[model samples]
Target: MSSPIQRVRTCRDRGSPMMTGRTPRMVAVLGVLACAGCVDRRFIIESNVPNAQVYIDDQPVGAAPSHSSFEYYGNYTVTLVQPGYETLTKRVHVRAPWYAYPPFDFAAEVLWPFHIKDTRRYYFELHEATKTRTDDLLNSAEALRLRGQTLPAPERPALPKVKPGAAPIQPVAPDAQPFPQPGSGGILPPPRQDNPLPDVVPRVGP
Candidate 1:
């Protein structure tokens, strides 16, 4: 038989307190409570072009008036497509909320009792596609050419042939002498003080 004191010690050891008995449940509840503030941010994208397909970062999200969610803030590419309209592309900048910053984010992730959500709306304008008049002008020009109504090529007068300019004659110096003929003796005749030939010669023809 056990002693009275020993029996009392055993009974006390067997009796579990509420704190130990509910430890797991209390932890789970605390975890759920701490995560309550974790939330996603959302934004709306709208365009004036009705029924235009919307795309974000090349992924088709929805049509105009689309609602999107993001976990963090950053830039995104938006594209709009519609029939008989110019495709529109633009860059969208989304800024982080106050709670997403360092110190605030810590509280928002762990301590806040409820989720905080941020929503923003954006609108865009799309322009219609325009037709170029170049093709019409070209077609008209080609039809005029085939009908021989085009302007005739103007006749160009023949340009006169320009003779090469004769080389300029150089002036003879007083002391310079003429070159001797090849057949004549190399020595030059002595200079005469006066003319030896007759001044006038009778002509045979009248």
Candidate 2:
């Protein structure tokens, strides 16, 4: 026969283990639902020339030593321009960190307990543009002019003129003579001795 206090105390003792066992699970669930970890990614672009304008994918970002947030990891086109410096253009590849890769990315992005920052840095050097000398340009132009003067001019054959709606004139050989017209009464030239004409007069009254 247990007293009333003893029975109450025994019940409490039995319930304490259940409450104790559920505390850690409740805490873990609250933690998981309270806040999720996040990943911040950005890139820093720098150049040897100070104040050089920077462009990413043809969109202007700012000057050298500039930075911008990015969402993807891949190839990017970068262009730099400044006064008295040759314009520079190049392709940059942003590689993912070990934690940023598959399986691990899920943990780092959503399940991790802390925020993660991923930064990539890039640097470029620029060279001064070459200056052209007036004397050198003049010398090159003079050499070209002299070469042109020394070369012989090309000769082209003259074309004969034709009247509109008229038949085109045929070309004649240099040694060919014009045929005499029947009404012009012009006599035919004698045959050459090298190619005599055959004599075949028909017999009379036969």
Candidate 3:
């Protein structure tokens, strides 16, 4: 009986020292480091899309970690990509100045068939030449010295000012026939005579 009691006491004594102590010094030390252990971690966000790449400020940030949440703070460029869809590049911000960081919780909702092939033939030189002509017309002041550029125009053409609440001009319908303008030298037609016939007009009329 004495041996069993001795064995139980020895087992209790052999338990972890971390669980055994309740000293003032021990409690103070635990309190100081507890913040590191209990700090709320932010999630590194990622979506399961094929061939997805991430970019920030036109620079790539490799593939996102599939495990745990993304805990980055500050502005970010979030992009999700699949072969069939257009490379969706969106500007995202995950900033929280207070505390370690806020919890990361964001998910991408995938959709299908977002873009068509860039098959439209485009020429940059043609566009550049056209732009040069347009800019030359709009930017005539560039031909002068810096100080002389802002001089008042020699001739100021009078242009009609559009009034507020003006009626909108609409295009004529393609199938519509043009009618003679009312009150413009055309004879004034009589008012439409009300039908004197019965409510149910006879199919065989005399």
Q: Candidate 1: which stretches are off by over 4 Å?
A: 1-16, 133-206
- Residue pairs in collision within model 3: 43-69, 43-70, 44-69, 44-70, 45-70
Q: Write the per-residue lDDT of candidate 3 for residues 78-197, one digit (tens) a residue.
A: 555445445666666655544333232211111111221111111111011134477886677666665586787699899667678996666686554445696777665555557765
Judged by TM-score relative to the true structure, which candidate is superior, 1 or 3? 1
Give the lDDT of residue 25 in candidate 1: 94
Ordered from best to worst TM-score, the candidate numbers read 1, 2, 3
Cα error, residue 166 of model 1, in Å, equals 48
Q: List the candidate 3 regions with Cα displacement exceeding 4 Å.
A: 1-28, 35-40, 44-72, 97-206
Query: On a 0 to 1 TM-score scale, where does candidate 1 land against the true structure?
Result: 0.58
TM-score of each model, in listed order: 0.58, 0.51, 0.25
**Residue pairs in clash, model 2:** none
